[model samples]
Target: MKSAKQRFAGRYRAPGPKRSPLITPEGAAALKAELDDLWRNKRPVITQAVGEAAALGDRSENAEYIYGKKMLREMDSRILYLQRRLDRIKVVEGTPADPNRVYFGAWVTLVDDDDNERCYRIVGADELNPSSGFISIDSPLALALIGKQLDDRVELSDLDKGYEIIAIDYKSAAAE
Candidate 1:
């Protein structure tokens, strides 16, 4: 199995997995909002804390300095990540011109063999939140459900889990 470093190098380099243009306009706006919040509010708060912590300096054993610096590094990293992701993202707002087929931003309802029902919206990789009923377009379940329609039953025959797609509900409101 490929380690995380190998996977990152292979996947992020040129000619790697084609970046999916899957986010909706709303999703883009949401990402922008989060990035904005981080930069405007959170960054300054953390920066101030780090600066204050540094003033109490003992370079070797100051817990506040260590933790504050760590937090600043983490915040900067996340800000960079969001910026890079937003640059490569593509937003899909309305149902694709084809109303019959499933694509990004479509809400799909699935049923397992026992007739258990589950709903999910196909979204960008960055916005997947299973608890909130959103699934990444690049995920296995989304891959199986895409291009399918209502009343279509797709069998996800895999070793660990098996599921069926019974209904497809398109989300009119884009990802927020």
Candidate 2:
């Protein structure tokens, strides 16, 4: 059996190459809220539970102690990551200078060859929410649409139908 240090050693590796550090104002706010919640509300409660459990004799066989410790570790890891990321992130607000062409924070309305319409907001990688139609600027779809003006056609190899840019709006776009 591996010690906790050995067991968790491989989990701390940094993810693949860093992408853009851009984040919407809302995304940054959400991340900050999460950090605050974890730091102020959750971590303290877990720390108390772990401390109480540790006072109950042998920790090796104490399930409460072990589980509480694990939760604390995970929370600490998240808090550290959030702090680091928030420090490095750039919060992008307002519409880009060129509203006619697609750019970061633009809500792009598209129509497929079959006339199927879809709206997607080009955002930073940290703000990706497919269900909310938020896509990363680095995504293939956004990559193809970036800098393209309304009425332009976008062709991607993976898609069966070509998408045409129908609308580009930034000022009035709101988070869902």
Candidate 3:
């Protein structure tokens, strides 16, 4: 039987909304650093641990064997994911020629009708994590904000809810 990683290889794309071709250089570098650390350090350590644990025999009852195997598998899967992502990613080192437009890698601030503020960075699908303040370029909010400027209001309606965003600021690292 194929391992879980084998079964998932080539069958899954980045599990997030669609994204633009551009990604911040910092974001790309961060991803590369993590991938490097995992492959060069963590993977080797986990592999050694698993090997040592398996050598103890009684695999079914061995706690280290079981847990080490699981961790090794997870690390392997993540390495594969990062490699594939790096192959397709395009890094944005600076602001685009047209600074007025909101594009991928842009830091945007929005104000809701109730005066609540939220900041988001438009990022590639692979790097999109709402908890990290990154939003996929294809997300409803990002799509609505793209090309809009400060003071512009955007209204979006879905089956269950209607929302509005007032762009407060949009800037790129190069613009800072």
Candidate 4:
């Protein structure tokens, strides 16, 4: 009696491994700000829109009502995720225990075999911004670089290449 869509929806799918609970102070602040904005501003506006749209009647055919409901659901999902994530995360501020080695929140400069230089900041999963060279602490490159000192050579199996640590800098939350 089950439809194809209903059967497929219940199919087994492996859950992803849990992310590390470590986060930079800045990342934690950003998440908190986002959560506050969603709860205080976005949810209220969406609720009003949904109410107005529903007043038009025939929600099944009202595009405005449908779109508003969809958006409200998405917003609620994000708010819940943010709330749980923020609650579990531990904000890492100040400098690493070892100033000479690469660790979480370290800005690392690396040189490739071809002599090309690159820079990346090892941050939390919630703050990974590839375009700005911020990589997740759970990333393969960060794993390889963790506890590595400047001038240390790191082999990245994922990239099938090796890079040498050229510089390591730890900027505080204030500097960022």
Instruction: Give the whole-model CA lDDT for all candidates, comma-separated.
Output: 0.78, 0.91, 0.76, 0.92
Model 4 over residues 46-140: C-alpha lDDT tens digits?
99999999999999999999999999999999999999998899998889678999989999999999999999999999999999999999988
The regions of model 1 sitting more than 4 angstroms off are 1-19, 159-166, 174-176
Task: Name the top lDDT candidate.
Answer: 4
Better of 1 and 2 by lDDT: 2
The parts of candidate 2 lying over 4 Å away from their true place are 1-14, 174-176
Candidate 2 TM-score to native: 0.88
TM-scores for every predicted model:
0.80, 0.88, 0.76, 0.92
- Compose the digit string of candidate 3's lDDT tens values, residues 1-176: 99999999988887764446666677788889999999998988988998999999999999999999899888889999889878888886766667666777777777666677787888776678899788987788878878876567767675343234444334544453
lDDT of 2 by residue, 84-161 (tens): 999999988877777899998899999998899999999888889999999998899999998999899999889766
**Candidate 3 vs candidate 4, TM-score winner:** 4
Error of 4 at 34 (Å): 0.6
Q: Work out candidate 2's RMSD over C-alphas.
A: 4.0
lDDT of 1 by residue, 1-176 (tens): 98898878855845657657668776788899999999999999989987888888685698888898898899899999889989888776566777667778887777777778888888888778899898888887888878887677666567455566665556444433
Clashing pairs in 3: none
Best candidate (score: TM-score) = 4
